[model samples]
Target: ILLPLIFLEKHLKVEVESKSETKGNRNTSFGVKEGHYLVGNQGIYKVCKFLGEGSFGKVAKCTKLGSPGFCAIKIMKSDRAGLREMETMKRIKHLDPDKNHLVKMYECFSFQNMTCIVYEILEESLYNFFQKYEHHIHLCHIRVMAQQLLTALEAINSMGLIHCDIKMDNIMFIRQNCINVKLIDFGLALETKELTTVSRVQVTPFRAPEVILGLYPLDKSVDMWALGVVLASSYFGKYPFSYHTEYDTIRAMVQIFGVPEPEVLEKAEHTRGFFVLDYEDDDLCWRLQTPEEHEQITFSLTFSSGCWRSILKEELHQVKPSCDPREKPAPQENLEKTEAPHTDSDQAKMPIGVKKRKKVFSVKKDILLIGNLGNYKVSDVLGEGSFGKVFKCHKEETEDIYAIKILKYVSDAKKEVEVMELIRDLDPDKNNLIKFYEYFTHRNVNCVVYEMLHQRLYDYMHKPTHLCNIRSVAEQMFQALSALKSIGVVHGDIKLDNILFADKNSLRMKLIDFGLARKAKELVKGTKIQVTPFRAPEVILGLPLDESIDMWALGMVLACLAMVQIFGLPEEDLLTAGEFAGNFFTSDDGGNDPVFLDLLKRMLEVNPQKRIPPSQALAHDFITMRHLSGESAAEYFATAKTIMGSPSSSSSSNSSRTTNGNPQTPESKKLILWR
Candidate 1:
């Protein structure tokens, strides 16, 4: 989709183009000062500092004079100016401007004789973030940023407005160290019908020439070009064909990508003076010719960046594409994402001679020091929970994978720290526990790092047949339990999802999710600990608590897998709670394996005090004793019951006990674990 530079200009051309500002308001001085109150009497906005200067007027940082809330106000020098932007923003109002992905415009009013529009304040630009990495951004980081840019552009285009200028400077994150970006600086925005009136009001490096050439009528594709160039810059810090003059810019384009097709040349405006048809080499192609040769024929390419010659596109491509941010990313294979960026000294040697940009603003790769995290670069999100989300992060020094958990502000960090400390004391080398690597705070959020794992047991639950190596999995969980018990920590929430695979093929798993975990001594009176179905009878009945609760959930998890394996189905169909789970043990034929059935019964016994504990489970015949046929040990399923009965029964009855026959129905199933 990039058009070839068919006709190269031998020299720069002077033509009418969009100027940054008009001379009419050059001398008008709006006597506004920082800390001065605006006209709004109830909640006056006092100016903080000037943010930027634009064609309309100045954009200022302002605070609600009496409150801590911050907002931005864009001032129009005269009521007549910025009408286009005002109308465009009003149209966007109905599209839910408050969306975190879009910059929200609150309202407009007159302040000190200037038309002022107030909006939510956002941090520095994506351009600033790009600079922080010194243009050595990772493809993974660019993909995240680019995908969001595409989504935002889709939203803008859907509203039937062209954000005429789509560049890194206009895209920004809501938080200094976050990826949720929003589009800003809509000064040149226009509706489809009004584009002809403002043909050139866009940034030069990101310019789309088709519409600017004054040849074809432009459409949304023009903005797409700008988006492409912006993404292109995240790699090299400059557009591909960038040059000091419009003429040489085309030369740069021609150098990287050969001459364009003949059709592009014929339809292109200003072509008559710059290119000629070449038929001598057995093909008709457009070739760039010098002026003396151009004296016989013509065409031209143009853009407005004034200093772009030395950094050629090929020079950028020379940087390894593996890490280059412009290598059109492959779509994520699975929804499981866990990316983050930073550098940790303990993990790797620091890059040398990096000079700090002075009084720098918010940039993604700013040397964020979070406790033991040291220096690491963040990748993408793994998943999110009620508290916050987890990202795939790497130690800059070691280049190893780790997970970073970012949660909402902690009113008390003491509990989490205590919990982490106790675990380190119990399992310092993290043989069983998902190792806690580091913990730190960023502004209002708590960022903690942990050992990243392969995949979740819940994520692979459909592969009940794969879990046939029951002996291996059971041992692993017990190992994790031994560590938890040593620290007196109760992983009250244990289910398939909370268990992560060490090597999915090997069926090795580990216990996680200490969010609901508490030290046995710190358990609050009347505290509700376990999840549904997996909840031990004692926990549900408000009886005294202990580590026995986990044994019950573990029994249920293995039992569910047993049902799936025995029934030869991909997943379990029966999931009843409390008394309703009687069907589990009472099934007429639960795959008819009495030995495995008895072990589960003892594990799920009604009395927590009477239930099998972890140490005993380790010695139980099912875990320490028996070998699996590699087939599921059976218990409870309509299919299993039918298989053991007569053929007439299998044909006459519907085997599926899943909710209304839909296995994925929420009422019929609960994700044993999600994070």
Candidate 2:
């Protein structure tokens, strides 16, 4: 009788479980489990698993009874808040999801007193995707994602809605293998008209200035700002602003974008929270509050009291408000030159035959025709240097983009063109050299056209570089130098600004800016060459100069990548014969790989004849990673991660060492010479 009763209870439990799977369970608790059925108004779905959980509720992967594929069911704890999100979805339901790059909401229903919204399942969020992939997104892919996100924003804004929580996590890819993405998570979304000063929205790092400052009557621009942050984070593989606290974030914003306009600050209710009124030369202006003052007003300890304060103070000193040209007083020479020049009475007093020359005027046009080959329309200025300016231009006929370097003098341009002709036989892509297309004279300025590439290494590498990446860059640059050496040409300038990404996706770099390049035979002793920070010892000492100076500059570049310092040879006595071997490498000796140090020493040899050539440096153990203890090498590179001190501290330390007039140690010598 006991066995029969036990069997009967077991049979009843199995029957109840089967019933729950088919008919759906009426569990009101937040602990919904797998295999539980959710009975929606239009369909029934079986909970497969919980994908993620948040303060609001859990998102579960589910399969509809008759559906072909999986869907994500957002089971919200608060039915009222869930209903609000559903209403926002309904507002955008008329727009085509794929066309607008928005997440497709299939249906919404109440399941056991909880509001559940079913959305088409996506591969993953960008935040999760970036975790698995460690490199920064390519610019082309970033542009595609930006365009899709902008489309999504346009659609949402058309419906009078703002996705207050636009972030990496809120963006999802339609498929893992493709670039298609859609915007999701409208939980914090609100109508533009509904925004208030007290409405708390947005993740702190991506929060807009207007929102952070408690500016009332917000619009869709906040979402635009968040999208900009998202795109920046994607491109850089990290957030552009500080994520620690609101104060840090705002301070970074001020440092990068400058202080908000006076009119903008005047309207902000929280203006005084982050800024204070200050007088600069008797002119009133808004200045960023010191961290101490901010801490006193907010009663929040954001940073540690001791070391962080000094660091923050140094950073604050570097934060100068951007200059406004309209506010500047004219120079005395300019004021006198423009003082009612050549009035009619003064012109009449001139010599008899001297007539006022009709003021000849020249108009600069945006469109530049290149001798009937094509019309290049100039866009933004890519950069400006001692030579002249590089303008980003595209051919009007083919819309093909190119960087046109317009030289300041025709003679300088002729020399560059001559150097380019020497390498014309070699494949620019194969040789890792900038590809020159054509050179011509336009408006008395010599313009040399080349294939437009990505960013310069100087601006692109802001964070500490990885050893693997540094090695790759070193190898490519060596190959470039070898090619130039093969032709007896010396790259006079090989600084960070001269190297650019030929193909950023693959990290393929190319050497650029050959304005100072010349044949090896043309190098003259006592002639100043190379950037000051990268100038070789021989060049500074007025000794013999040759292609080996380029090797020295490349060595400096590698040291910069590894140790984050650029030791310039500014003083002649610093490189005097026996004094070059002081305690410079001793301070941070433990953090660097011995093999790398050996390579740097070889390349940076004070004797130009003994400097390692590009061929030999290419074969160095540091570049090849040959015969190295794998574990020790790994440890050294890992330790190298900490060697890059904050830029401000490094600059300050370098300045202090250089300004003192004592007999310089090798470290101080390096510091003084590089800058």
Candidate 3:
């Protein structure tokens, strides 16, 4: 009995043999059946078993007659298609001989009137490898796979070819560990310079937005987009725009990436058919129209002036939680919930004009401006995650450096933008808030153009843990939260990381990451969005919250300063500080700064009733001892209105409409803080 070769032929460059390795007559059973023999250009291959089926054909395992090895043979339905893939393989193989991540095509031949494309036997497709593991490949390993996939794509690109259909299924693993994979199944591959034979290419979920939008003159960039989606899916354990249906893919795209540019919408062939202009906030959120609404929006039809506004208002009112009618519920219904993301199907009942955001995405790269609405050039990557990446960008014509965070989920970015607006209204001066110059949806990313400041307190902490002006820093935070309380804002996640230095000297700092902040009254009972270590006792104990939690986190921030002073690191941290709450910051122990300790005691109180609210903290001795910032909400508003001019003022005034349609703005926020 011939033991099937442990290895497979590496290349299609094979030599015909004079003698057959198999003893006598080669077993002739059937197509793709084990022990069946098939003749190729080089030798007779004994069929081992079936591998998998693809768009163009079925793949099966086979052993070469003269060679001591096994190989994969894809039997195509038609010779024309099979040879096309074979030619593509040959081009790719010739393009890069030194190294190729693509699966090697050993040989191709006809048997029983069917065309078969042969390849080295691969263990499994990347999709199957990941699915069997419950989509839990560590990013470290996936990174290696990504490098290999990119190399393969570059090889294909060098040959001026596009792997039109790039997905986990088309990427196969060479070995069981799955670190090294190969690009397989070029059945739908097309040369970049070839004439277009199809209107669109790529699988539904993995398809690029440009392809879906009909952004023509497609190039190898389309393949790059597919690679991004493929890598993102592996990293995130789901598609950046997790659409289960082809019809919903557009909606998913819009949701993941904010609405495309107006020009993109106007130029896109399918826009009219798929999306409708939602004018809820005087901004157009392109929501996929329902069957009836599709035709109306798809075709050029003059809309009744206020037809959308009324439908939008009705939809908004219906979605508003009825349990608490007065207080606007935090839009965090999707946040941290043990459920799937709200899908388009679930929102089908809502009016087309309803501003239900589509969950979709944009991968990195491309020289386009971020959020076509804003004029900025993205340059470098600052940070990255499954949801998004922070890019170093600057105003196109100016040196105004800014960090542009491109989020995968439009919901996350939209939520953050809402909180920023909420905070801005509350603290118009932005004295204690990250100064948001503008935010717009650019290239499907929630492009937030903020005043790029120095490193965060977390980064500064490394330089000198022994905070010199810890009280002064604490004073600014107290004021920020105090300003927030006056307007009913709660900074949900306050940590050293969220507290950033606003100036070069690290003298002034502001709070950021407002995406999680909720209204004090609207915060769901037991809702906890704070990082674990910074979580207040009330939040951890499942109690109701108020603006006091921010103060609690500030207390932890102060304690962290003290811990850093004493141990260079927070040993047990604030969570355990409650056990010795009374003497936690005592003079007898250190007396480092009695004023700071006094404030920490009240701020760290376990009882929400006992915790020092921002209002009283401003009047505390620790704050009055220092100089006030002198930037009152009134003065700041006056100066801001002056700088913004008439147009800005009008926009601000118009934007004052509340969630409940109230046109009245909140009273001027008056707060004092240490400079």
Candidate 4:
């Protein structure tokens, strides 16, 4: 019901008046007759064919009566329309013109009872293209589509506006010299600075969890979550989240992030409309819940990234709005600087000279040869990422094999090279961190030379393992977290794929991909704005962040290792793992499996404050007391076997230690495994 009568005319003062004139040239600046038609004017427009129709009006392809150029005219019922939508669009006209991936508005008119607005036409929408190709879209094509969509989103958001509708259909492709995307259908656009009721205003499936949970006063971030969904859809050909009904979808969302801890709930209640209720009947009941039950709990994905701009801000005031019938053109200087200063300092080092890179497999440049720094002959491409391709190379000076990260020009080599250099120089020492040697730009490729590693953790996690030493796994993960925090940088993006095993023993791990890493200084407090699922609840709910996030990720890694030991499944397989890893700690349901479900709860506390800090994690009874009593990885495995010696000889050796940790109720411990 965001109609014009709702608020516009009631508050606005229209000063235009009508004039006594001929039928063809009736002059009423702010009024219209019941049956007047602007098309009847010979100097105005010559309507040719109808194009389409929607809730607003009907569209027709037309030609200016006096001009040779063509445009699409949308005819609306003036008698039934309000001026809010028109005014809103008018304000954003120059921000993103229809000519360049945006539908440009020409002249708007309401002569008789009919209102007509002219616009430039485009070929087709991305929705149609995506539907035709589905998952068949090549990776390169997907990246291009993502980039175009990002550009459109960035432009719109910079204007302090929200495209409440960001589905594929709203994006169009211009079929000219090259394919480019355009954003259209401003039917649901709104200035981000204004506040609105929290009923609901987004396409489901693509909507963010915050929107679904009645969280409003939302910024441009809601759009980033949708962008992630669209990107996921490109690869899978369907919404990452889908259900039979909206209720089910909402319920699923709640299951993922439904209840905050008591303290968080208390703090969140400070907000005007936040809900305050504990999930359990009583705090004690929640406390009684076992770790296994907690591990099985799953929440919807959360996303937090400062990637786009808000246009209503002073930064983009320069982009001139389409000339208003009543207002004069704006100052020229304002139009030139059409965006706010980069708020994301991560990109601050990314100089403007570094052109937006293209999507390609290998660097389109020569090998970087440095005798004193490092002599690495770039060989075959090992893997590719958003910035560049990682290649295996042999260092001629040291005759040592290494992995050289070569940033393609299209991948924005300057930024990638800069981040690499920072990681090499500033990153603290940790066996879990990839060693950096040197960084340089060679012609078109930005090269990052680093110590070579053998296999990705993703490859090793799924391999067969008879018995895993939980203690060893915990130590390795803890060391990584410790090292990362020491450097004042959060890994930002941490998952098995980004981890590399040092050798065949699989005991050592090194982290990679600092492109998404964030400094401790820049993060918004309580917001765990990093990777989702493995994401901490604080980050999920837009809370400020801390080292606790690393602990949460480490918790997921431990769960991954434990899952491998007990269930013989990769960490991701647990995403759909039913209640077998349920949030209950009954002896029969779980062997009180310390490593399986119980230990997971202690680590994956939804409340960042409640989550076991890395220092405390090292002392968790289950990890430190039971597993690591001066034992080696092999020795511990032997002890685990001896403890499970015979079925009848069950004196409950492991069971006796179950009560040792003042085990919190199974209900209190809910774990969202990393899958």
Candidate 5:
């Protein structure tokens, strides 16, 4: 049953401020305080203190008079909304709240022209818990939460009702230190048949695509979609999508899931509001409207100083719906090819083979044979690294595509194959490591097959990426490194080119190119490892290396993505026990985030013995975003813009800063295999 305790998304600190202001006006309004009694049909509850408050009103932690235990009474501002929630709660009253993982409701009553619903007291909301813990929820904990939430959803769905708002703030634990959670806040709940296009529901980040498109007669699938988002946010420790605007959310959804089906779009009442019909390859498809297009259409009326400015019909007609079923437009001729845009010297320095690769193999005619005479059709070159050229290929009988890395030398190829074999037992997707399929010799060259992934991180981060996305990348890479370290392996080459996104939408990164990988026991002193810019200080100092070197390189990768610089090493005399402490540590201008700078300092420690490990790096405040609240994260993004967008802080400058004395051009930042 629905509970009255609806804690709004505002920070807890803000709630305290509001409480103070409300206390000053407590006598003027119908505000209830400690000592006030809420009389319900079941019993009388003594108001203890406020649990939370919103526009709906305050929920008080109350003790039942003459009873031993405590309870919660939701005092809603509007009786109409309160009655609606009570009715929804009554519909689910038959189901066992404990079994279904729903918050137990006691009774509803009116007091001082307000509606108050009594409920069994629950612990803190998941939102408050996250604020206190500030770390990624373990998969095991997530699994337990997912199961209980799903059970709650199943129970609600069985009654043919939708919770409408399934977010972290709506879910609360049964008690402290317990994984069991109950679904709360069914204030927006409605029956399936009552759904409509105009119904405003759901928090922005958790809103479904169909709902955003204004689909009528919506089903329970929207609730399921929100639950998926909630789970994703819990695991990733951030919202899965950028929720700054409906346009931004839709754009991100398109990038990840592609455009919605045409039939679905056609059924949507407000499809034209966010998408435009365009012809591509002689077929019409709906494309997301640019932010400018959306703003022009939706913000046509400008109100300034009590005056209104209406948009002209001509301006509105510019983007008139072309895909309307009633409209039959004239066919247009195929567009002509245009000349390639000229690239400046700086633009030319971007990683090569990032754009569409040239088709080097005649896939339709000759078949490329690998070990066991497996007939594969080579399509195009995926990329070229220090090890060899990787080709995109399709097996004869399967539609699945695979990346075939052809090593120039069999010796290097065999070494990489050995490393791949060592990591074969670990789940590639779970560990964020490239999935190795098979390896073989073809015409004296070694070939390794892997689950094909998208472009390299180098190609993806042409501009400064969002800090949220960077955090996702960092977390995944740390998982990959942790997996390798568990098996006593080191991914010696952890450069941008060696890490690829598992998918385009989610920023699921995987570490690639283990050609330079070595066992922890095999590490030797004075051996050069990693590419130039990502090389650890210990590597340059002729000190012994281990898996910690990968952590240092990963830190460098994160620094590059954030467009920040690692301060130069101090004089040898200043280095004590290989740790950067005292003045040396504080002198580094490692951007604004102190947590990030702290993690960076640990990873970039000059002494290999003192450097942070992969496991610890995973828990670093920078990676966990522990102290960063939603508001602070937004602030961090604002600060990140100035750092990433500055011309002086570009990749070129970063390369120069990381170099030893000699500043290298962007083109010269390729992987260096120093023997």
Candidate 6:
């Protein structure tokens, strides 16, 4: 058998040969000969060969009667192309392919009994590439790919849609001068705009445990979980959960990552018994059982290196009964005796238990105190706002200065002991936002720890004397926005107040005060408009604010930063003493800053329909100056390049072992890592 070469001839003349190496352990069939089939009655096209098949239909490399280059035609049954699926595909097609990582659909054709969609031909499937370069997949590579996928899903989700099927196979790679990947196959995509009351149906393998265990009408977060699995698989060179057959895969998902049983619920107060546990809350039950009973259960699940092992430790705790007298006895071993399980060299033994143990997350009760929450060691209070209080504090360890924001009664502080708990849980790229170190509350005082900053954009702007350069400030704000954009998050409040500078040169800034901050998926819950003066028109008009909102605020901040740079101070007409000033901090100079005026006009367009998105904002003549100067954003934010979109769920990837060396017992490993 002739093995297929990596490089193929441009002309589709000779018969293609199958490569001997099976990429990604995928099922391969190579006997079909190259031929042409009538797609519809419109025209005849030559079919070089079959590419692959999905639930949608067959995909093949075909050339039109008059066209020269090959195109990928995805043919589906015309009958299935209904209002729902077509609408999803249409939106996916219109998305900015250059900015969004979703596949670019050139066109869709429909005739009599067939529906065909054409796309730019990708050289190989992501799975194929993974198979080709399995060993070379690094955590950094996973971060880049995962970030791109997150951005794509963020766009889909922002539009209130969900991609039901996301996996290695559906991801395609565009390899040339740059590595651009596109998410393909939206046959299972569903519109979730009005799905609050409806149920969400999805595919397996890529499905989250919540979906598999009958969780309904899943949100865009389901895609987040799937992306997590894809990223984990790419890094570890295997799936987190895999089986011989689809049935086994489903069964394993339930048995291993499944929800807890009711009878096993003694002392499990903080977690919901019927739902899967989230690691973010520290209080959520990670393990279900006690130590002694953890040694008996024999079933084991496969473990790929880099897979979250801590969640497994929690699952073991749930299944094993604690030897502690207060806990119930371990569940009967009869069930395990009948089940066959997959095993690996590192697989832990399943714990046997009837009692559920309380899951612990990172947030705790005691608060750690830094300097005075209201007073800064170095400088007086620079600014205070509804979200938190900013004090210019000097670090005892680094001696490097930072402006620390002390927030009491954080938006959800009643339920969340610490604000950083949520931020840390999200695992965001910390560079864009001020880094929070610890949190402690003392007698009506809640202090959030952060790196100190030299001054705030607010202080720098209103100063009578010009200290640092303004263009440098714009560069910092843009860098922060770029970082936030990449993380699938929106900095709802991106004004002078929130932007804090680390040093007196005042060129670099970090976003602070996240009281009103939320994940990108949470659009409808909070107040639609944040800081109405500088708010985007869409937000002001009560339209759902996405990244465009950030861009809008970014535009205004850039303008203000520019004025501070050029005029040596903020225009008096724009500066206000109180926090309740109008949304747009404009000056009587009538938008006099020429460079900023042009930039802000585009960002503050009355219609979100017309407002510039982040990708476009980065391309704007004003902000692109840095890129034009041939500098990557990574130069400023050292960690920007390593940010993964988010963790799959609250579950930690690493699993801990028990005294008996059993992998499944709850009493074994301490589940320290969450998010």
Clashes of each: 34, 5, 12, 48, 0, 46
Give the per-residue lDDT of model 1 (tens digit) for 1-675: 011111112211111236355655543646777777776534678899989766567788998856887899887764555665677777777775534256888777776677777888987776665444332333323434444555566677778777877777788766543334678867777777777554455665555555434334455556665665655555434455554444444555455445545566677675544466778679877786653464333343344322232232212111111222123122121112121111000111111122222322221332343546466676767876545567787777778877777666473244565577678766533445677777777666677778888887665444322221443455556667667776678877777777787653334466776766777776654566665656666665666667667666665565544443333322233432445444233222222224333443443232223444334443444332244232232212322332222211223332212222111111212322110
Give lDDT tens digits, candidate 4, residues 1-675: 001111211211111111122433323322323222256333477667666645455566777757786676667657433254566567668674632246777666665666666677765665565443332232223434444455566677667777666666666655422334566766666677653543355576556544544444455555555555555444334443443333334333334334554444344322213232335554531221122332233232323111111110112111222112123221122123222110000112221223445656544334545534766776767886556678888777776888877765634455444555556654434436778777776665567777788776555543322122333444555566565556676666666566676765335567776766666676776543445535556665655566566555544544554343333334434533556643311111122133322333433233434444323433444333244333233343333333222212224233111122221112212332221
In angstroms, the error of model 2 at 461 is 12
Which stretches of candidate 6 lie above 4 Å from their native place? 1-34, 37-44, 81-84, 193-200, 242-675
- Judging by TM-score, tell me the better candidate of 1 and 4: 1
lDDT of 6 by residue, 1-675 (tens): 011112111111111121122343222322223685544344556678779754445688887777678777776556553334556777776678747777777767664465767777876666676445433243333434645676687688777787767777778765422244678877767677544343434444555544433444345556655665566455434454543223334344444444334333222332232233446566655443221222233233322222222222221111221222223211122112221111001111111111222322222223223554332343546555443455565555555555545555534343333434555544333355677665555445555657665555665544321112333443445555555555555667666666666655324557776655556676663345456545566654555546666655555554443333333333333344525333323222111124223433443221223444434543444332232221222332222221222222112222211232211212212211111
Per-residue lDDT of candidate 3, residues 228-282 (tens digit): 6565555444444533333455554444344566666666676665667788688
Top candidate when judged by lDDT against the true structure: 2
Overall lDDT per candidate, in order of appearance: 0.53, 0.63, 0.54, 0.48, 0.61, 0.47
Q: Estimate TM-scores for all models.
A: 0.41, 0.46, 0.43, 0.35, 0.46, 0.37
Instruction: Report the C-alpha lDDT of model 2 over 1-675, residue by residue, as the tens digit.
Output: 001112112211111111122212323347689999999988999999999865557799999998788999999754567789888888888888887889999998887778899998988887766665545554335545655676688778778788888877789877644566799988878887887544466777667777678776666667766776676566545555664567887777676556877877888788899999999999999999998999999988674211111111121111111123232222222222211100000111111222333322121347664634677888778876655778888898999998888875778899999999998777888878999988988777678888899877776544445443555566677777778878889988887788887754546789998888899999888877776767777877877777678766775675666452232232434433435423222222222234443543453232223445434554555444444346544543333222211112323332112112111122322221221
Clashing pairs in 2: 567-674, 568-673, 568-674, 569-673, 570-673
Model 6's TM-score against the true structure: 0.37
Off by over 4 Å in 4: 1-43, 66-69, 79-82, 96-100, 131-136, 196-198, 251-675
User: Total backbone clashes of model 1?
Assistant: 34
Between 1 and 6, whose lDDT is larger? 1
290: Cα error in model 6, Å: 12
User: What does candidate 5's lDDT look like per residue over 186-277, in tens digits?
Assistant: 87788888865434667776777667777766666667667766765565455545565666667665654567777777887779988999
10 residues in a row with least lDDT, candidate 6: 339-348
Error of 6 at 81 (Å): 5.2
